[model samples]
Target: MRIEMTTLAEQPVAGVHICFFTDSLEPSGLGVHLLNLMRWLNPARYEMSLVCPDTPGGRWLMERAACVGAVVHPLTVRDRRDQASIDRLYHILTSERVTIFHSQVGISWEGMLGLRIAHRAGVPVRVVTEHLPYLLTHPGQVAEHRETTRLAHRIITVSEGARRTFLERGYPAAQFICIHNGVELPPERPLGEAARVRQELGVRPGAPLLLTVARMTWQKGHSTLLAAAHKVVARYPQACLAWVGDGPERPQLEAGARALGLAGHIRFLGQRDDVPALLGAADLFVLPSRFEGHPLAVLEALASGLPVVGTRVCGLEEAVADGETGLLVAPDRPDELAAAILELAGNSELRRRMGQAGREQVAARFTARAMARATMQLYESLLCEALGRTDGE
Candidate 1:
């Protein structure tokens, strides 16, 4: 499946063929980012393709990619060591005549094998976007991630903080770039949609509805948020915390909530497609993540004109301007989180002001079009360099 490298002049004149690879099997922030690229990348200048898992969860992304005219290649691999999968990927890359192979990584080393296969297939330009900061725990993964860094022609980090983390880890500064994650500013929710959502959740009107949209994972700090919810509810009995999204930690979190006697105050809505309406109904948005790579939830919340209460960690810190767009408290501190949430809950005017500021900030700096344009520019620069051609050419 080795593809012999060809000069740009040797190929028939056509748009650049860019193929994206991801191992994600579920709808996630990564999927949203990919959709943004698909929607915004000019079809006149580039042809797009996606290689993703073929599972039911993956179909959510597959269907969306197709709607945007990107060719979808359903892929399955039992494990990283599955040579058959690797060969299959190589064949796809070679047969598709991919000009640019861009892989998205949730953590460091994710989709590394795809990059390796793309490299072996002699793809002219290879890119990998790290959606999170580097992990410092595992020595084996650290080594593998370094190999991934070498395989990529360029490595994209979703936040400046994430890029700095890689630079501090000795990755070549010249090879990495920081591109902040962005979201499409959703259109206004249908009239009465917010009320309908609140009614469905059994939240009474005038009750403070604190909303959190994130997977029920340890890294998301759901436990810390649950603790904060306990404190917030004790003070304002009418306040309700609606938890959206689900993951492996859900059962444990539900059990903890029951144990804390928070059954009446906390509602687990699980995964729903009506997040925009939920955001519209919520009084404030809270994300108590221990770490992140520019969470889309916070951005969406801000876009929905809701002030955020997040942790003062790397990715969250960058998205939320403390005391302006939202309040950022120290991570893992339930008391601080509770205090901040209560502070916003008590002041409607302050919440409105901050929410307006957040919306303005997003419109000015973090739009899906901005992210896509930056990414496409990077792709073009790298492709031109690989072909020994200038941008003007």
Candidate 2:
């Protein structure tokens, strides 16, 4: 017997061409989210292309996107306001016959510029995703937000908290959509060598292990985590804290850990591809972000069957489901953070229950398929409205 498979290119699509632009493809949450979106989106319903900066990270993104059947392009967009860059982007938009231009607004200055170029190119629909909410206190950021909002046909926020912030600041209510970030559920059985991985990380076989996977940036609250680690070790001498991911604050954070005599108990593991195994070998997951825009790490931790202890910030607030799946503490409060970690650490039963609850929550609400479906629905709505306007014309 012979079987035939339909490739994405051979399928009839909705004829809506969308080009997604990003700053770089560094191994960040945004990159991971984008990759998942490309993979899950119904290729039979729309055409997709990804444009990123011409850099190593951009090349990495291109390769990943290509693997998922997305057409990828790398462009040299050095400055947002540079006429040359704008001209190049405009040319690409026109040449590709792009119907919609989608991007994340705040991360790359060129994103806003791309929106303007798309508008000028007469693209019927333009969508921008806001992954982080900017404070209204900053006049410059507020101005930039307004400009980006005016240029886009719609704005997508990763959480309701982010949407509320923008609405309160006078952005049009109808223009915003809150779509929570999602993750693929972990395997039914743990995939990695849990015990061996823990031993390699210098964690004892039977000691409690706490894991945090976040860039060492000020916004991520590493300083507060370090302080909390000090209190954790004092209470449980055998406990070990592993810090994954790297950033500018690594030196300072490492120094703080040493200053507090936590060098032995704290391990800076840097970035690793084996995140699932890391979570499996751990007793709990902690995220001390001062703020967030629907962190994928929390969802991954939940899916990994690990109880999360994160700051009571926007996205985390929704992800944690406080007291159900995990605990939430005030941002920047190391003492409170320490107390929460200890609360989970001391009780194995509580940890196990919370972990089970978290896994259930992720499976129920936050899956990569859900995120892609919501996005595609939004795209269809805009495309229909565009068609309606053209018919009236």
Q: What are the C-alpha RMSDs, in order, of all predicted structures?
A: 1.8, 6.8
Residue pairs in clash, model 1 = none
Task: Compute the lDDT for candidate 1.
Answer: 0.87
Predicted model with the maximum TM-score: 1
Q: How many residue pairs of model 2 clash at the backbone?
A: 0
Q: Which regions of candidate 1 are displaced past 4 Å? A: 1-13, 77-80
Top lDDT hit: 1
Query: What root-mean-square deviation over C-alphas does model 2 reach?
Result: 6.8
**lDDT values of the candidates?**
0.87, 0.81
Query: Model 2, range 52-96, lDDT digits (tens) per residue?
Result: 876766777788888988788777554665677767777777777
Clashes of each: 0, 0
User: How does model 2 score by TM-score?
Assistant: 0.91
Report the alpha-carbon TM-score of model 1 versus the true structure: 0.96
Q: Which ten residues in a row have the lowest lDDT in candidate 1?
A: 1-10
Task: For candidate 1, write residues 24-74 as lDDT tens digits.
Answer: 666488898889878999889999899999987678889999999999989
